[model samples]
Target chain A: MRTIFYISDGTALTAEAFGRAMLSMFPLKVVHKTLAFIDTEAKATAAVNKINQAYADSGERPVIFHTFVSIDIKRIIMSSQGSCYDFLDYFVTPLSKELGIPAQPKTHRTHGIQEDTGVRENYDFRIDAVNYSLANDDGSNVANYDEADIILLGVSRTGKTPTSLYLALHYGIKAANYPLTEDDNMENLQLPKVLKPHRHKIFGLTLDPQRLHEIRSKRREGSTYASLPQCRFELQEVEKMYRREAIPFLDSTRFSVEEIAAKILAETNIERHRF
Target chain B: MRTIFYISDGTALTAEAFGRAMLSMFPLKVVHKTLAFIDTEAKATAAVNKINQAYADSGERPVIFHTFVSIDIKRIIMSSQGSCYDFLDYFVTPLSKELGIPAQPKTHRTHGIQEDTGVRENYDFRIDAVNYSLANDDGSNVANYDEADIILLGVSRTGKTPTSLYLALHYGIKAANYPLTEDDNMENLQLPKVLKPHRHKIFGLTLDPQRLHEIRSKRREGSTYASLPQCRFELQEVEKMYRREAIPFLDSTRFSVEEIAAKILAETNIERHRF
Candidate 1:
């Protein structure tokens, strides 16, 4: 296997994003390493030594995806025995020309608190959203639904919790989820009375019956809740209620949290509090 | 102000990451739009119309950062008035040569459930980690500490919760956090008895007293818990305990959750469950 390095002066998150996106096209296994906060010349020199060692050990040039603000530090990294790709550097000139402004590169601007204004108000939005989502998770705090940007409705194990947290963490969207369980009378389901007034903000998630069965089986083995027939029955009733109530929903059986959140955002008009 | 668009046949997450990293170098304000799941020609044409309308409205060429697996849809987007940059396409040939494999373009492979093996086992790790973190949040379930990859210890409002969730969601690491409050005896702080057995997995978070005061003040307007003296005393005691116990710690006052998570991963040897 080959070595892939994501190195940057800051968090190197963008470098990881770039490398992962590029490598998804290739069906190969590789080792992953990240050297973050490499802001000093000494640290950059040490990183070059590691890159050279990986090349020596693997007998193949390591693929380096890096973003750096300091020219001196980046020069050291470019001198390493690796095929370095700096996506940000490659696009900077053309982007500057198109925007008619020179690029003022700065460390920590990509994934740092300083990216927001000095007050860090935008960063606060994310923390606040996370707190809100946690406090409102799983119908624990229905009284706070009016403060939510969106509410997620789903049966148990249909992926409402992770989706809600992802929306809060990534987009600073206050997403509270309510799980539809036996308590909701799955045999004849209706939108819970508490959720009726906030129906406009509700989004539903459903999964394939087989998928739901597999998921629940891992939690409560051999129970009716983990049986295929029970899973099918619950899903059929919940989905019917979705249509009857005219609530928008997604079958999240085959989607990652990122895909589900993006689909919801694309379909809904909820405002994202963070860029 | 100019307009910027992130368009992709998939979730458009990679495009957004690329665009945000590149734009952070320049001090420019622009409107942002994302066109996700544009896998069809009709959707591509509609996206182009939106891009062209934005150009006309702003009297400036819109900056488009796009990724697409469909050549036909990408062609339609290229014909739009916006200046498009495809970083994935730009880096493909070089990366392909370095890896000795031809690029296999596929939609939904980048940010979809299909990124994992067909079993979706890696996707399950993320969801499982999220559930674990939620179950163990804020010292709620101390008996499960042995299962945590890391246990974050911090005083109230020092950013333990968001950091824990970020570690779980992004890296698939089980991060359980315990809060050090007045209940911990701020005057004479010590590592709780329950955490002593898992000392190797402990990471401490501390914030500037001023920042903590501001954060707590928002939740409680005129209380001693939100007072500067109280904040200072609590943080001072916590830092003393961390050093006395020889625990690794961070002053997270100047970092975002991403930065804090990256810093923790850099300092620790905890195995990341996701790539």
Candidate 2:
């Protein structure tokens, strides 16, 4: 197994998020072992020394990859002479292209502070502690279908709502979801007719009957919908539909909303550029 | 505007998260941004030169700050001696320490690609997924408490539910909230008396009366709670109570759940270390 470090200078949430996403691709393989941080300048050398040691201590030849913080530093590291210097030559070139970020060609005056603050609390986006009103504040679903990066379809409480919201907040992915209501389900082929044409983009969700029953119980207890027997039958039917239709489906019973969302993203091969 | 490349080699989410947090901190300034990534040798070099141009072209001196994925790259750049090599030195020394990580370091081989995988399809953690054996799985307040990292206290629909779930999925902060019914309101504090001691950790939610009215009106057209006048009066009373008890609050009329949450985290000085 190769050890990979997802380094970030900001809050590291971005690093963790993308890290988590990559791991999800190989769910049973990548484990984010530990998170190490450096928030200031004095610690830069120490952080460097440790990475260098990573190579020396390992008896095996491991890929020692590294990315730096600024234009000046990149140039400096690119020019530095040392045993680890060769490692930099080995990793920095190709890594930049896949990410779409351009390299710093020259070093001008840099606002160089050496410590790792991880993030700067600048409060740069809010004005008067209120967001500027959206062009359409009426919640009329003015968002166009064409503009949606991905669309989710599931029955109510299948964890779609939270999943859509997570993508929006984390990846800025504009996601839209449609619920398969009782009427729609009653009128269904294994797949929703409207989704037939968008088959590749469409994904399905299913839940263990008992789990669905428990979740629905919290929303509307004592209702027929929340009854265990009813849920059991509904789940069986949904699973059958998914199999018959050959739609990619996930059991939402065990996954956290994010996990379920990630699974769908993975299974459906939803190519989200920004999100 | 100065450019800021929130670069990441492995996970872009962490960089974006820190970017958002930094943006929130500095609402007025526009920092040129890029959450682009670098994972291979070529892409890494291109990204280095891109930052070079941003700083080189921007007439003024700009900070070339980098974080997580960039840590190692920072060293690479620092090692590359040049006109900017002196500046690179400042960042390298301190970074070395954090890279060393774990004062008492623990090393182990990776077991999976991700440390956690949402809950997993087997509902492995869903006690019910196994047998009814969990029925006797420890008669403790454990599940109830284990279900939330923070339990919000407020009246019905004061934005507790969304925020609670958001914290859970986003920060993995287990959050559950209990509403302050009329009974609790009369007691003058939103928090349940039993939970008062944990008050510092509890966040009190309140909304402008008119806004509250508009929200309630959607669900209960003619109910007293939906009346404009009643909403105004309730809001006044709630604000007064908050002041009397010195409970911090935010007006939810214009805030998205994410914004409300971000504000609360900031005001409460709760640093979600993930990002």
- CAPRI-style quality class for the chain A–B interface of candidate 1: medium
* Candidate number of the best lDDT: 1
Angstrom error at residue B167, model 2: 2.1
DockQ versus reference, model 1: 0.76
TM-score (chain A only) for the predictions, listed in order: 0.97, 0.50
Candidate 1's displacement at residue A1, Å, is: 0.8
- RMSD values for the candidates in order, in angstroms, are 1.4, 13.1
The segments of candidate 1 whose C-alpha lies over 4 angstroms from its true place after superposition are A115-119, B115-119
Query: Candidate 2 on A41-109: residue-level lDDT in tens?
Result: 443454445444554555322222233344343343223221221222232344334224443322110
Candidate 2 wrongly placed segments (more than 4 Å) = A1-149, A153-162, A171-191, A197-275, B1-5, B18-37, B41-92, B95-157, B177-203, B210-228, B239-275
DockQ score of each predicted structure, in the order shown: 0.76, 0.06
Per prediction, fnat is 0.79, 0.04
Per-candidate local distance difference test: 0.91, 0.45
Interface RMSD of each: 1.4, 12.8
For candidate 2, the share of real interface contacts preserved is: 0.04
Residue B271 lDDT in candidate 1 = 87
Q: What is the TM-score of each candidate against the true structure?
A: 0.98, 0.42
TM-score between candidate 2 chain A and the true chain A: 0.50
